[model samples]
Target: MSKISVTELNKISREIRQDILDMVYTAQSGHIGGSFSSTEIVTALYFSEMRHLDPADPKRADRDRFVLSKGHACPVWYASLCKLGYFEKYHLSSLRKINSILQGHPDMKSTPGIDCTTGSLGHGCAAATGMALEGLMAKDGRRVYSILGDGELNEGVVWETAMAAAKFKLDNLVFFVDKNNLQMDGTSDQIMPLFSIEDKFASFGWNVLTIDGHNMDQILESLKVARNTKGKPTCIVAETVKGKGVSFMEDVRNWHGKAPSKEEFESAMAELTA
Candidate 1:
């Protein structure tokens, strides 16, 4: 597969950010901040870095896998998938509606390209770990990637699964922690105090890398480093702003799960388009 230029990927990410705003604004009930925080990572993976994707055949063997551990941010994931041809653009407006495959969280059975159902935080990481183990055992070259929220690390299960991944030496597994520092209700420190996210993952026996999550260049390079690593799982600690592209919402806790009002939506759209 030919690599998408950095400029193109950046442009695609901007479009995905707009789609995210549109989805949450239309649904009137999606996690916008988290979705925005996740846009670039998803765009980079699907549009540029990943391998063996057949949008027409999402279940194709040998394809790389992505699990949205921070599953509330499915708006961004769905947007990227739609833009990537996994589904139609028209479905973008149906997010969070009853019976819509584009639910508030990703549904593997309902959504064409989703690898696993997620929403209950922490479990997506575990599921990705299992997939990585399966790939390693089968000796397949396929790689598995997962995106997690910093707030979700408060769950003890994440560490348990982290230990299991390292013990099994699942080198094909790479996880990105969207360390935006804020979660619903308050900041990570105010809520759970995620002491040194990089140290925690490193202590768990994984190769750890930290970078500005919003920087496309750093993200692309970090992903390359993760791919080259061996004998253990890798974790990229992505320091990101919660509401990345929009002016008013950046690092704002209220946007964690709030749908914007009409005025706010227009303001957001203005900035996204500008």
Candidate 2:
């Protein structure tokens, strides 16, 4: 696959955001804030960073793997996959419907490109760690990538996985902490004050980098650095605005899991289209 320029990548991110707002509004249930927040991160991977992904041969060995550790933000993932031709665009509308492959969280069995089933807060990162270790043990050069919400760090299991990834020196694993600073309830500080996510990962013995999550240049550069890093795993703390690209939803806690009303949806779509 050819490399995508930063300009093109930004266009794709905006399209994904549109898909997210449309999915949530149509379903009247989904996590929109975090999905919007992490849109660029997911876009960078699927469109620019990761490699060896075939829409037809999603299960091909030696292909890179990605896990949405913050599973509720899966509308972004579904949009990315659909855009990449992992499945038909029609499935995007079926999001969260009963028996739809595009469920509230990812299901590996039903989804063609999903490498893991995830929705339980800290479980996805743990599963990603295991996948990285498996690739390591097999001596395959495959790399595993995952995205974690900053609030998900409150989970003890997340820290546990951090320790294990470091202990094994799983440099093949690279995860991003979506430091959007907001969660379902309120601001992350109001909920569980994660003082310094970068320092936390560094203390866990991982190579750490912080970047503007919405900046395509920064996001692509961090992934390059992570790939070149050796010895320990890399954690990129991506500072982002919740409900990014949408004027009304940005940084608003209420938008975390709420579907936009008809007027709100139209407004969001108009903003994204612009």
TM-score to true structure, per model: 0.98, 0.98
Best candidate according to lDDT: 2
Q: What residue pairs are clashing in model 1?
A: none
Candidate 1 lDDT over 59-155, as tens digits, reads: 8777889999999999999988898788889999999889988887899989999999998989999999999898888777889999999999998
Which whole-number lDDT from 0 to 100 does residue 148 have in model 1?
95
For every candidate in turn, the CA RMSD to the true structure comes to 0.8, 0.8
Name the regions of candidate 2 deviating beyond 4 angstroms. none
In model 1, the runs with Cα more than 4 Å from the true position are none
Q: What global local distance difference test value does model 2 have?
A: 0.93
TM-score of 1: 0.98
Q: Report lDDT (CA) for all predictions.
A: 0.91, 0.93
